[model samples]
Target: SQKIEQNSEALNIQEGKTATLTCNYTNYSPAYLQWYRQDPGRGPVFLLLIRENEKEKRKERLKVTFDTTLKQSLFHITASQPADSATYLCAPDPNSGYALNFGKGTSLLVTP
Candidate 1:
């Protein structure tokens, strides 16, 4: 079975600093990777999507990079703030037309 691995440990960073999170996968090669942010009581919110052909993508203070050779993706939040704290989930779509596989997610805590 395909599997996604995210840091189970909570990532702590100071406000105004960059926070980098990682997502790794095995047993599958996806055409696209999706990133989501989830708060405590709310469902995940779409953040960004990076295609396999694309090496990097950015939106505002967020950036994502996909490395097909490494079978890994990195999500980055620049100049992060306390409000940016949340659980980030990564979904790798194997171009199955209905990609629904998501990892347990990594928790990020931005401190003042």
Candidate 2:
């Protein structure tokens, strides 16, 4: 069986700093990785995706890096603000013809 792991602790960062989160998996090689942001009660909003063959992907103030060999993925948010606060989730698609399996998300709080 495959498993995904993320930091259980909530992260607190000052506004305008970069926030980094981590996700790790085992027992499977996914075809792609997807990231999302979830507020207190809302569904997750898609952030970015990185293919197995791709090393990194980026959007405006966000960046994601996938290392297949290491079985790890890192998510980054640059110039983070209070509005960026949310729980970040990672889903890795195992290419097993099933839907994405999401990991326990890490919470981030950007304080002013």
Give all candidates' CA lDDT scores: 0.95, 0.94
Q: Whole-model lDDT for model 1 versus the true structure?
A: 0.95
The alpha-carbon root-mean-square deviation between model 1 and the true structure, to one decimal in Å, is: 0.9
Please give the distance, in angstroms, between residue 83's alpha carbon in candidate 1 and its true position after superposition: 0.7
Model 2 lowest lDDT segment of ten: 92-101
Structural similarity to truth (TM-score) of each candidate: 0.97, 0.96
Predicted candidate 1 versus true structure: per-residue lDDT over 14-51, tens digit per residue: 99999999999998788899999999999999999999
Superposition TM-score, candidate 2 onto the true structure: 0.96
Candidate 2 C-alpha error for residue 64, in Å: 0.3
Cα TM-score of candidate 1: 0.97
> Which residue pairs collide in model 2, if any?
none
**Model 1: residues >4 Å from true position, as ranges?**
97-99
Model 1: clashing residue pairs? none
